[model samples]
Target: MYLVHTAHWQFLGLTLGFLAWILTMVTAGLNEWRLWHMDDVSVITSGVAWVGIWKVCFYTHVLPQMEFCRRISMSDSFLPVEIPVAQVLMALAVICGLAGSISGGVAMRMVYFTVEDRRNIRLVFILTGTLYLFSGSCSLVPLVWNMNSVLINSTIDFPPEYYLPVVPVRQQVGTAIGVGIFASILMFISGLMFLCYKYARHTLRSVAPRSTSNPLRGPWTTTAQRSNGVNKGSDNPAFLSEEVSC
Candidate 1:
């Protein structure tokens, strides 16, 4: 008989995480739409929307299957069937999708702020886009691997009474791990870049000099005084006559 080892808590955690990711993606999509309709649309709008679409798809299709697999596995009355690795991979893909969405969203926000530095803006887009792409790829890994597994494992050991379809659990798990790693890496990179940009801009502004006015002079006033050759001491006749009595 198949023994179910359902990690209910872990499943719940993952579910919540996926939901949060979906929320973030939706928020990003709305933000992008708002920007797009505006006269001052940003270049980052498309990028953000791309990230959001991937996230929504992952949550809607992939995450539910993963949850179902996990729940069925933990059920006491269920057969002792192994969970396919494909499902695990799918879960991981969802996580990666989440990370990508977040990274893209943040990058888009940065662009919207009109962060004058072109270099910084480009860097933000490159890093975030890379994360989004990598995670999206990782999300598909389990599905691909599982299909391959099923094709290869045509004749597996199974009792005549055991009637559960063999799903690719291991492949799924591998995919999930891959996605999780990619997501984590991107999160770290984007966060570091954001902090560095903030610090550099702040430091540059802090040490800059302030413009000041001279206490007793304007440009025209100073020029007039110089051309007139008027001396304050000349008002005293005694001081003037001492040097040139003629």
Candidate 2:
């Protein structure tokens, strides 16, 4: 049985990629991306309102005061352009990040050694890194664009039924957007790690000359058991056992 080795780079990259993927999921579901403070308002009893990709949350003042949240409609004529774009980009980021995380997870198999070929290992690393890089890019676009919108105090032209301000004086970027930005940076670094792992693996292979005698090769295949640097055929009894008793 071959013993699999997990490189330091692969371990670290997978760990970070997993974290970023989780954060991306959370960011997609979170409703705190855009905040509006209505504390001093005479219109509604709610102190503040927050908007998310899927919903907009405010307060209702009927017989009993309650939080009222509504699903964001993409067909609404008055919605800011950033909201829809953020939704799509964030959704894409989640999907790509999940794929990259899985790839990274598979590449760092420590015990199974299922994929033993050096060429295959390098391919896995490259593919994993590229996916993560794309995930990071998808996450970053919405964050920066929405942040720019907030900086300019972007407004929604909602009808009266929506009960949302066109341009609130106290509106600002919310914590969720900041969290997404941080997650995007983490994803980018994680992608770099996997790519670096590929480069480092290549460098080590070049230094050690691993084609005929790779570190990844099982130790059971001793020097005497090899023919011209290649492992002896399975037909040879040497492959069965190094020492046998009669």
Instruction: Name the lDDT of candidate 2.
Output: 0.78
Query: Model 1 over residues 194-239: C-alpha lDDT tens digits?
Result: 3333212323335567547565655422222233666533145576
The segments of candidate 2 whose C-alpha lies over 4 angstroms from its true place after superposition are 1-6, 39-43, 63-66, 110-112, 199-246
Per-candidate clashes come to 17, 0
TM-score for each candidate, following the candidate numbering: 0.34, 0.74
What overall lDDT goes with each candidate model?
0.36, 0.78
C-alpha root-mean-square deviation, each candidate: 19.8, 12.8
Candidate 2 C-alpha lDDT tens digits along 88-129: 889999999999988887777622455445457777888889
For model 2, which pairs clash?
none
